[model samples]
Target chain A: MATTLTREQQRQNTPDRPKPGGRPGAVGGHRNWLAGVAGWLWLVVVVVPIYWIVITSFKEQSSYYITNPFAPPAEPTLGNYGMVIEAGFIGYFVNSLIVTLGAVIPAVLVAFMASYAIVRSRTGWFLRSVNSLFLMGLAIPLQATIIPVYLIIIRLHLYDSLLGMILPSIAFAIPLSVLVLSNFIRDVPKELFESMRMDGATEWATLWRLAFPLTRPAVVTVAIYNALTIWNGFLLPLILTQSPEKRTLPLALWAFQGQYSVNVPAILASVVLTTLPILVLYAIGRRQLLSGLTAGFGK
Target chain B: MSPTATPTTARGSRNGGLAWLAVPALVFFVAFGVVPLVGVLALSFTTWDGIGDINVTGLTSWQAVLSDPGLPHALWVTFLVMALSWAVQTPASLLLGVFLANSQRYRAVLAVVYFVPLLLSSAAIAITYKALLDPNFGLGAGLGIDLLVQDWLGVPELAFGVVIFVVSWQFIPFHSLIYQAGVRQIPKSMYEAAELDGAGRVRQFFSITLPQLKYTVITSSTLMVVGSLTFFDLIFVLTEGGPGDTTRVLALDMYKRGFQANLMGPASVIAVILVLVGLVLALILRRLGGRDATHSQMEGA
Candidate 1:
């Protein structure tokens, strides 16, 4: 499958002009072959582990041990997935869903409003300071602040609850969200905003009716970006929550390791089930996720 | 509507009204980010368990962190990972980026293939690799390769190397994506002109691509440094800094002190040092990048 794709790509990649036969031409040809080989090598290195996980997820415990690990399962079964689901995988999934949505929605919405204000209120020292504040937040690693965060959560009586995770996650996410959203908002034409003002629209009205719609791409970008981060978060849940029931997917996966030790197939089956939602999300929003991640660095 | 009745008034009122719109975000940032950060810094100077009354002991925790026996080893391991990641991941990604950029067809599919590991959770990647590298029934033994079967995670010498390889695998795609974006920004005319001048692929890459990617390389390097220093979840899950603490990094050290040992003060000290290292590295890289940009600009002139 991969070879056919590469062959078609090579056909399309043929240059318009014929090459001059010389030392440089020979070297160029050698480099192209090297590139092709490296490309295929990288494809294999990436695909094999993912392929292993999916295939292993389908094998029963006995077959997983008996069959060739690299081969397709001879007795493919849904038993591993059923065991995972029976072990409360759905509960963890719902917990992850609630926390992710609870955090990302408020973070993005607040960031959009804040970003709009930052870009539009050009002359205010307060807004300028706020922008700088967010930039400074980029340097503060969350690991460094976990100690105080735990204490604060305990003080607020929110420790061991999803709200504890959601609040701090939202807080940490705001800085980057505002940074990206503000950059996107600044690209909107000044005339569009001015015209909206000329039509006697209040600033709030213009924000919803004009700026919101125009910056939809940035909104989606920040939304998916934060959702991915919060969804896969481990440290927050590990530190903040203790109950077996409150465990998010990543923490649940960790817990499963100890409980099902030596049960490789069942453990891997849980791993596959836990990651399926995020993989689906990535497939849907990959372009935005990629562009958003690299967007800040590009500047 | 009148033809813009005093544009300044409209602008002034709008600005004033909207300036307050940032208040909610500001509150969150200050309460969660700013306060906690400041709290951690202050707490580093004191001895306080989560339950006990705080006692300020000036410079004690700092002194302990500086002299702690385990810290130096953890720092060494972290530095090893950082150096290895830069040595291995960066150039590989750059080459992959160059190849992908030149490949016209199947670009989207190929990129998605490369990015799959990155999209999955760190815990998931760690578990997947753990199973794949399992000494008994893993892919190694299953494939019947004699040399492939080994206790990868159990051996102290090999455990750190395995962790580094996994970390590199997960992040290489990200660096490649960045380089791909950088490669796309290079104007095609330059490459075409080089080809016209009989410059081979190697020379063109050295003269055109490398020079154009200087800023990107620096930015990515800084990110790699900071990321390696603070990386926790994957390493924690994979080894828990196990097999005689061979793979322990600074973050894990902090986790142990704060949570397991209940040494909050010392943990705070490690946290402070980690943040300082990140900030100093970022500033240095920025300064270096700034100088290079100006130098190149002068040469261009």
Candidate 2:
């Protein structure tokens, strides 16, 4: 093909045209073939741990102990999942769901208003101070606050309750949510706000009718980020909740390991069960995540 | 509705305007965020066993910590873990990001693999690793790598290394994603020009790619430092500052002194220090990143 193309090119007057194909093409083709294999190899590395957990969840106790740890179970069992659910995973899941929603809803609402006021209210000491105070949160690691947080929870008698878990989660989540939302709100068209104002809408009404709707993507992104953070949270739940009934999924999974120490199958089973809600949430919100990443980082 | 307002009326509205919107958040934050923080700061100056009554014991915990044999080593370990993780992960993710960015076919797959760890709960991952690293029945034996597997939670030096590795593992994906996003933004024209000049892949990366990714490098490094310094959950679950307090970080130390040992004052001191560290790091990052206004604008989240 290259020889034929060279002869054809020799006969032609086109200067930029070159020989079409040869051994060099095969080398490039081989590189692509190698790249394809390498790509699949990378995917396998990513998928393996997840696959391991899922498969382990289905294995029996005997399979976990004395068999090839890397091999698939010859006979998968539902017993581990059965035990996890029977152990009241449903209660923990419900506790996590309610608390996360309870905290995130109000937190997002408050942040939405606060961000609006800061962005819309022209420059002022009060707004500056509020923004600074919130930004200070970026400095205050939750680790530093853990001891004090524990004390406060204990004093409020929130130690073993879901409310204890919900409040601080909201507080910690608020600053970043406010940061992201405010930046997004600042980017909203000034024309819309002016139009709303001309139509006799109050500041409150304009905020709701215009800013809220315009900032939906940012709002959704913040919500999903907070959801994952709250759902996967272990420290708050671990420190605050003593009873199994009030525990979140991570805490419950932790507790499962504590009680069933060597029961590898049960432990893996619980891990699978525990990660399900987060996985479901992530899968559903995967589109939002991509948009959020692109919007936040793509400039 | 009017944009025009007299100064007096605007001031009046401003005074009342913030009232309705600000009160709830003010109350919430004051009660939950501010009070606890201040209370803990105050606690740091006092001696309280967390029970009957509060008493200001004035720097006794601080003195105890300063004089204690364990404090320096713990701090050292914490510092080591944070530094080592940043050192190891930054390059690894950068290389991984470069590879993923250059190879279109493997981009999606490698990215998912790198990021899969981020999706798992740290506690779950820590526990799984704990089991996997177990000396006797775990994969440590089968792989003939048992000696390499420390009783991660039980050993001193290894405990810190294990925690750092675990935390870094979780973050590499996140950092890679950031790098990938930045790398993808480089206009094809630049690469094409470099190729026209007969620049090799390595040269193009060094001359064009790295320079273009300055903002990403800064952002990711700052995030890594801030994250590593504040890290708690994985360390807490995995090591619990075990094997004679060798793995205790500032955060873990604070927790133990304030909550476990009932020395609220010292714990608060540690908390205050942690806050200062965060503030200092953020300040440094802002200064470093400040020169590039476009950088922060690009890093919207």
Candidate 3:
């Protein structure tokens, strides 16, 4: 314990030390032709379906039936996309956007604050218990608590509303968010925090100015990860909300697929649309998201 | 997360004042998380139709759930999915993780392409697979391939198999990502030392790499197994426990009983079971990983 901190402290003090790069790549790499074959085969297995979804989504309804499923559309058309959007897809997208942004921002904020407390006041009994409680929370799969959550939301008169989904989403996201954020905050050199204290900064001020800035990448990573989870969430929306007006994208996609069972292109179009936003976000934050994908469970 | 985060001995205020910073999150979790946890247990003991007045019922829901043969089947199916998916994913992910841990540039591109599945929702994935497997207009018919045109989600065994396959399709990439990180963390010198000892590639892997990945295997397996417990969205959309309840896992069982059938009490009981099973499995997997990994992960998490 002491060794890691001192070593990290030394790394911080020594400007010449290039920050530890991503763990050194595995050695004896090409010798494993077997993993390579599996990798490429797995890649094909993955990409083929995704490829089918995109290309078939662009095909005309009849062409979708006639063309090779693996081939690109013969006469590409936006008709499926048009059909999807006009059928209340925009409203579902907006509801999803609202639910995701509403839940993720506050979830990450409060989680960040809690993580700051956990890391900054490590030995404090209350903070330690709080930290451990969040850890224990991870084991209590949020799905199991759905029935109670449904009842509670009804009692609170939040049921069937976006707020209903947002509240539980934030709660469910807390444990992992705190896990990832605290790990990142713990890495901010204590010497910097000590200096921040010497500068007469309140813990709150230091949290925002020092700890938060230093750990911004972790914050972004946590936010993006939570956003993806909440955005793609199905159960909470399915169980919590009732009205079609309130359905999030994932729930709407299911319902749309059910309604358009025969309209494969339209259904695939909805699938494509449901995934596009996160794919864009993934493109933007791929490195941080990949590095922190396990939510610090790996660490 | 380090378990070893010592208290910052910043003089003058090594105090508990920062505790309030944690209070907001605690309050939310307690109300929504901890309270609901207690609430689920309490609800299990009550009779509520999910709408009408709640009446206290002693052991009635338990008695009903215990007597129902469907409960055992549901539990068995849930266990099957967890075990099957774990067995399928672990080795595949471990190998792929080791494969991607390489510095090869094309492998990085492969990693990017492989991750596309992880971004899509379970509902979307299920929908895509549903359409792709449609007998009349799906890829099977389009490509004129009779073998690809099977009623994948129709028959009991095939539906069960499709559920497992779809779960793997959506999740294996994410697990592979974790393994990649795990493999990368392995010290290169371990392999170098094994090479000096006249170890071949396969020998080095068995002697060094596999052993070093013990913690990673446990972590990934724990996540995979535990996460599979609540896999409601995918299975619900794909098969809806179809072809006569072959794919009806516990999460769906709870949902159907509570929300669909208006039997909230029995559903709450199922929810409690799910929670218990999850905690037990997590603990068992941690134990399998040994004390150091357990102390580091459970205590440190």
Candidate 4:
């Protein structure tokens, strides 16, 4: 905590304003009513749909059309959620969890090690090139490679399998993971590594003990970010996995929406159910998640 | 600070064992990422309906994709979405960022709420919009707001407009959060100096805020532009490239051709184009911002 505070103070001292010290400060906006209006107006735009979806998810389909869309259900029923679960959303939910965890765990572990190597052995030209390759991976729209990925999956006899999705997802998650992890890993003090080394610890041991513990927050942030992404991923499952039994939540949500085109509540319930885990996660980790996000991107 | 610095540490850290640690990530990336990157280019020249044996016929796929009017239309739609969404999101997010940067208790609450859309999957958000914008049984008909009731994803111009609006609705919060961080990062002393110079709040925003956020703008815009190219799931779930293919962006075009129609070669052509456009745009944005590798890695958004 003391070190972090000092580091933060150090960060504050070295302002990254493009114009040496020319940062806009005094934004005391008591009369900035236009922006205030815009902010609240955007709030309505964001909240109204969510509000409608929640209320609609609880309403019976028989009364859904006759009632107001924005109004709370006069006679709420749990039938929509019940129908959704009965329609196998729980299975889809489980598939999504497997894919998310399946991809994220290995991606973070492998990425953490790569980050440690890049930061530790910065002098190695080959390692530097590898880091460069990952950085270049960032600029590529890795999604565009889905066609060839599909081809590879088919050839590997892994089509229609959750593992197929997991492989490519891990590959795509790496570049950013390495960048963020390396950024955090670089912040670990050199003295700490030297002390561990002097104690006769191997690089691997020092890595797990010193680097991993110190960068645990970054590791979590990377995991959550990748998990959210993989959980919400649709295209991979859409093309790679063909069987109903293999559908992840996003693909299942799309398929479920198509199946229940007439029953809006049931579809809405599936959306809610699929997102509930993430929303619950957000509620619990809102502070850590948001700050990690802002810091990960903003830094 | 020690004058000797890190000669020992730097040399000591250059162990060969440390270099091998990057192997697993490198191997995975090469097999999946680097290989596919090259594979897309190679596949573009071949004619194979995704299930059949591989056969290469150079330049045929390119010729077909280039000659087709659909390609240009898709490109134009893509260009429109990228430009329009950037224009809309950049200003609103910048202003909203400045607004949210204030450390009021209410603002904290607002940030939490604003982030809700970011949590929801694009498929869910698109599905929600689809139901809400259903001309007959939607929010409009339910509320009797005739103005709100329209075939939002059916009509051509309106469909295009809906695409941009939905894109903005889902993404502006995220970009706004980035800008908010950018705003907070501004040194307070600069604002004090500007105040001492008698600059009003609006004037200070124009001068200090605008100029200092140059890099942040590039970072956000790069993500916005490059990210817009791959907006397949949102557009697919919402409109499936729409009533007349009016919303068929490149990503959707690639998917439809490759998976739906079994035309992998043509789709690979589109994929190659996407990679080029992404690279070119990223480089242009990077060049525009001069140079800062770390700041631009904010492209993860």
Candidate number with greatest lDDT: 4
On residues A98-203, what C-alpha lDDT tens digit does candidate 4 reach at each position?
A: 9999999999999998999999875788889999999999889998999889889999999999899999999999999999999899889999998987886777
Worst 10 residues of 4 chain A by lDDT: A23-32
For DockQ, candidate 1 versus 3, the one ahead is 3
Looking at model 4, the pairs that clash are: A25-B191
Q: Write the per-residue lDDT of candidate 3 for residues A121-181, one digit (tens) a residue.
A: 6578888888888889987778999988898999999989999999999999999889888
What C-alpha lDDT do the candidate models reach, one value each? 0.80, 0.71, 0.83, 0.85
Model 1 misplacement above 4 A = A1-31, A292-299, B1-14, B291-301
Task: Write down the worst ten-residue block by lDDT for model 2 chain B.
Answer: B1-10
Q: What is the TM-score of chain A alone in each candidate?
A: 0.87, 0.83, 0.89, 0.89
**Which stretches in model 3 have alpha-carbon errors above 4 Å?**
A1-23, B1-14, B292-301
User: Candidate 4 — which residues are off by over 4 angstroms?
Assistant: A1-31, A292-295, B1-14, B292-294, B298-301
For model 2, how does the per-residue alpha-carbon lDDT over A65-93 read when each residue is reduced to its tens digit?
Answer: 66666788889999999999999999988
Fraction of native contacts (fnat) of each candidate: 0.45, 0.32, 0.61, 0.55
Q: Model 4 misses residue A295 by how many Å? A: 6.5
Q: What is the C-alpha interface RMSD of model 1?
A: 6.1
| TM-score of each predicted structure versus truth | 0.91, 0.87, 0.93, 0.93
| lDDT tens digits, residue span B25-110, model 2 | 55566677787778767877787776768788887877877888666776787678778999978876776655554433235445
- Cα lDDT for residue A45, candidate 4: 85
Residue pairs clashing, model 1: none
